[model samples]
Target: EKMPLTPNGKLDRKALPAPEGALQTGTEYAAPCTVTEAKLVQLWQEVLGLERVGIHDNFFEIGGHSLRAMTLVSRVNKEMSVSLPLRNVFFYPTVEEMAQAISELERLEYAVIPQAEARDYYPVSS
Candidate 1:
């Protein structure tokens, strides 16, 4: 007897397709490094109508196209205040990875301020 191979001509059953551990059993998601990733996943689920979306899920595999990606980016910009370069999203497709990258970007590019309505300069009284 011979073993079976997948349609792609690779070892099928021997490959072990699913995750080894209980990665997604809980109600709460693992906290993402940046707000952008958390919101991105939420938006993606709403746009795609998915029951539950894992951070590692592939966008293209879930029927995402360039136009949808553009819409997603627009939402991200409006909501997260992060102007993601179009290419960067494709490069870092996963939520966790993208979050780490965005967190790095925030640390490097965006200056953190304690107050939202902080004046640009101290008020001058004459």
Candidate 2:
């Protein structure tokens, strides 16, 4: 595809069309359903500087870089109260995948917690 260029020979970013198969702006969008997805969508919007972000939108395709990804991971840890490895962001670039990874991390954390052991109780005479 040919990129639109300005009179000065610079790429006209504004005139460039959205990539094929990408969600177009101003179209009806489906909001996130679960809390995790909602949080991710909000974070993506803030981090990526876009007005609307769908669950299936690709993070990198929307101008996300390594620094932004790191920032996103940090925010996710702070907001979601979970420790997620940085690599997970690359592995799960989309909100849906990231949310699923967060859910799995939460499940693993819950599973790792040690249960309290039962203790015998003795009555004391006054």
Candidate 3:
């Protein structure tokens, strides 16, 4: 029950045992592919308090809940600068799916601009 230490009294990182992948969470580990996916992974890991989070990992399956989902949404909206609805979390639990959704949303980011209402009739070129 002791940690491997070097002569300098520091923890020996090399001596430590490697984690056995996803902590046996029954899901194959797949690292994030794109920038969007990578960012989602980082945020999921932070919210779930896990050392590793794969792109294909299910948010709820990997210790996620409604409350945590809200927090994750808030972070995504603020950091990613996109309006990611909370319902999307459940709709797209995996990072891969979420990333795709994000890209689609980003594509339509400026599509919701409101325009000034025009009068009932066209204005004359007076």
Indicate which candidate wins on TM-score. 3
TM-score of 3: 0.66
lDDT (tens digit, per residue) of candidate 3 on 1-126? 799999999999999997675556688999888999999999999999999999988999989999999999988987888889999999999999999999988522323358869878876796
**TM-score of each predicted structure versus truth:** 0.53, 0.63, 0.66
lDDT of 1 at 20: 70
Model 2 accuracy (lDDT, Cα):
0.83
- Model 2: residues >4 Å from true position, as ranges? 1-29, 107-126
Listed per model in order, the count of residue pairs whose N, CA or C atoms clash below 3 Å is 0, 0, 0
* Window of ten residues with lowest summed lDDT in model 2: 106-115
Supply the TM-score for candidate 1. 0.53
Clash-forming residue pairs, model 2: none
* Model 3 per-residue lDDT at 31: 89
Q: Pick by lDDT: which candidate is best?
A: 3
Which scores better on lDDT, 1 or 3? 3
Better of 2 and 3 by TM-score: 3
Better of 2 and 3 by lDDT: 3
* Residue pairs of candidate 3 with colliding backbone atoms: none
